[model samples]
Target: MSALHFSRVVIVGVGLIGGSLALSLKRAGVVGTVVGVGRSAASLEKAKSLGVIDEIASLEDAARGASLIVLCAPVAQNFALLHALEPHLEPGTIVTDAGSTKSDVIMAAKTALGDKVAQFVPAHPIAGRELSGVEAALNDLYLGKKVVLCPLQENARTDVAAVRAMWESTGADCHVMSAVQHDAVFAAVSHLPHLLAFALVAQLVNAEDAALKLDFAGGGFRDFTRIAGSSPEMWRDICIANKEALLREIDTYEKVLAHLKTQIKEGDAEGLERVFTRASGARQKWGTARAAVTNVEP
Candidate 1:
């Protein structure tokens, strides 16, 4: 298949994900003009100055003759953004997203766009950093990362293929799954971990000896809570969006934690060792397999 190129691509948020996508497409020569639309004027200016975007336009104007529009804002904002864009959205303008959650955004699109819902292809790129904003955006951020596409049944195959090509052009591998599966999988791996990281830091900060503990924090603590530095507003929306799945994961985790606590308190050394050894072996195996298969671009 010939490489698909979008002449004009509009990024609604222009943050790290959006900016990185713009940079990636530019680097790959798959897009002409990168237009940025956002609530923050200063951010748009910064994205422009940094060459992340070629022009700043309103959502209304940005929709005109756009080959592709990507909504990279916080997951919850998708509803409002889609609602606002629906009226101005022109025919043949394909919309996609870089949101972490899929089901909620798909529902939002169905509600807001109605018949135009087919034009929206919900996607999530499994790529990011501890840093955020346009300034932190890197052209290679999506290189070798996974992008999940939960396309609506109403979506044309050509539209789905176009969206896949767009992501593939950024050096990402695209996988197709139902929105329900996408949400459940990410809830376990991504959302729950971020919640735990933030909760750990919250526990430490609220402790009476927080200062002392933090002053002596070692690599273990740092490594465990590293994701706690992620965007609070963004993760807040994600947790809320995928609340049901996340709550289920949290409940399962609590049961495991209780089991471990009991094992420790009861001095069941063998039981603890059994669990730890199994976990360590699984993690190592997964790491080795992933490293062997993944083409991590430098």
Candidate 2:
């Protein structure tokens, strides 16, 4: 189906992801009437004022007639949203999400939605920054980014394709994967990195001479810990939800850190050089690829 076919787009949770999706869909002319639904009246008002949606809708009302319902809320609230909207959702309506984690979400949909699970397509757009809320939303947030869709075995191909088309309308490339694989890969690349950043920043903040150290922090320090500034509540839910995979990743990281410490303590310059060189080269390659795809001038 063409992206333009989705006439009524309902976005739950008018935060950064939801608000941005609403705006982008309208801009692309993929949606006729965009509806914002959330518990926060203030935020819903903000989204409406910003023209993020054509109207503000109650959760039940939003799902009643929506052709596409996008859950852009925190992973913790997904189950509740599903339960509340399941009874109201029209048959053949497509439901998708922008939640970071997917396994629990898929499980929730299965349990709460039953047969409606076939109409649901689980997706995570691998984009966004530390900042959040509708105020921080950018129209081009998903431009040239990768969006992973975790489709269950029972999901209809037409529904999955429709979800893909919606995301592609905003210039995102969609990739398909199983929910388990998605959780495992993100646990290492996304979740683990956030944990490390939070830990590193927390250690420094709790130090006896924190003020002195903070005063001397440079660009590297700022860059390394930038993600530590993300919403604690959101990250907390993610850590708990993906505990098993995250814990394994953490253990592996600890071993690597131990090896690096041994090399440093022993004054093994060769060992340090080899490790740093490989890490630096890999980062450089990744940066080049990102720059090329995003058309970043620098």
Candidate 3:
């Protein structure tokens, strides 16, 4: 639709992100053929059956002459995939990813592809749901969503433009950032929050009155823990992949949490109110800005 197109695009995971991307490209009429590849043959077959992909191919066969190859698998699986792709990669092929953690995957791409690493552009689509798999994938999942691209110094401008155009075709607005910056930012805002949500849910589940506590949980609890319903395997990889940045965030959070504990133990009403007021104000401001941008409500 935007005069940008890909002849043969390979999706390495064929799950939520990958399947939705394939569907979006098909809907936009920007792709000639979408090939699905993954660890599970059943998943690939399911994606093909759902019309999310035009065909199913092995990772080895999908790399040759591919216009674009998007690695949408769990972050931990990327290195081996890239290593496998290196031998079959064509000069015309441009590789990218929808990985949540970039720095680690960039490192993997560099290690796996060596001098050809420039062909790989690291990207993260700031969109998804608690639901996963091809069945949960939607054509409009990336509409009005944000995508961050971290390009390497050796990357060609044309290759970068192709990746940008691909995401824009799906109605995603793309922004550029350095790999280190991308990792640190997501570690604070994304990874830490997911970690907290999982921790809270795990705590409740381990409690003596787990069922009672869960039954009594209200809207606030549900809202806060919603991300806990995300794929455990995916988050596990993201957490470890970006652990250095996440650990720093965790240490900082612990200090803030300790201070709050002190205030509560001393019955410092003013202190508590000040913190609450600041947090509420910031959250409301962010929500308002986000609503204006996305035009979607909670």
Candidate 4:
């Protein structure tokens, strides 16, 4: 199969990720046809009205003809969708996903797809905002972003390469990692941060002094907790799915917090300054790394 030619690309659950993918595929001219699959007739209609897909298809029907199948649903729904569509998937079809946590999805694919597990490539695109649904999608969402593929030991090399090529065609830099490592890294950087934001905001709102808290919420508070506004359902699922890693991250964060508290209690100005300086330097370095990854030179 030509790297540039995808005969039929099917996107399951045409929400933000799926819709954005369809738009990107169209922009890249990589697929001849894009089919969107969703249970909600309204969402399917909205996706079509927004030009996210060339056509809408039932899950089974879409699986029958797709050259590539992209699962863009919530992590919790992936297994059920996999089982339902497994029997219908055409042989040699390349199946991939945009779920946040990968291990469970990979396991589900293996169980449901069985011999066809070699055709599946579990992927996570490290780009999203605190929004949901087809309306939140933009064609440029994946451009210059990192898309990580967690290829299984048994996955076909050609299938993995094809998946990498598809994401690269959209101007995304692709990397390969094991499912366990992917989940561990994301649990710290992605899942734990989201959980913290949600917890912080929820704590404030539940306080009797909520109005006073809001009045004092300036740029720092807003910026720090921006991810708190993301869909609760999605974050809830992510936290539960990656609980072990997230718990470890939470423990690490608590230790840092304890150090800060101890310094404050002892009135150790030098200690506090040193801590702040180290944090600021680390944040600056991270910012530079992020800019390097997302910035493309013309």
Number of the predicted model whose TM-score against the real structure is largest: 3
What's each prediction's TM-score? 0.97, 0.95, 0.98, 0.94
Pairs that collide in candidate 3 are none
lDDT of 2 at 156: 88
For candidate 3, the TM-score is 0.98
For candidate 3, write residues 1-298 as lDDT tens digits. 4588899999999999999999999998999999999989888889988999988888888887799999999999999999999999999999999999999999999999999998998899999999989999999999999999999998999999999999999999999999899999999999999999999999999999999999999999989999999999999999999999999999999999999999999999999999999999999999999889888773
Worst 10 residues of 4 by lDDT: 289-298
Candidate 1 residue-wise lDDT, 1-90, digit = tens: 236789899999999999999999999899989999999999999999999999999999999999999999998899999999999998
lDDT, candidates in the order shown: 0.94, 0.88, 0.94, 0.88
Off by over 4 Å in 1: 295-298
Q: Which 10-residue span in candidate 1 carries the lowest summed lDDT?
A: 289-298
Query: How far does residue 7 in candidate 2 sit from its true spot (Å)?
Result: 1.8
CA-RMSD of model 4: 2.2
As for lDDT, the candidate ahead, 1 or 4, is: 1
> Order the candidates by TM-score, highest first — what do you get?
3, 1, 2, 4
Off by over 4 Å in 4: 1-3, 296-298
Clashes of each: 0, 0, 0, 0
Off by over 4 Å in 2: 1-3
lDDT of 2 by residue, 1-298 (tens): 3535777889988888888888777777788888888888998888888888788878888777789999988889889999988889899689999988989999899998998888889999998789989998888888888999998888888888889988999989999998889999999999999999999999999999999999999999999899999989789989987888889999999999999999999999999999999999998999898788788842
* Model 3: ten consecutive residues of lowest lDDT: 289-298
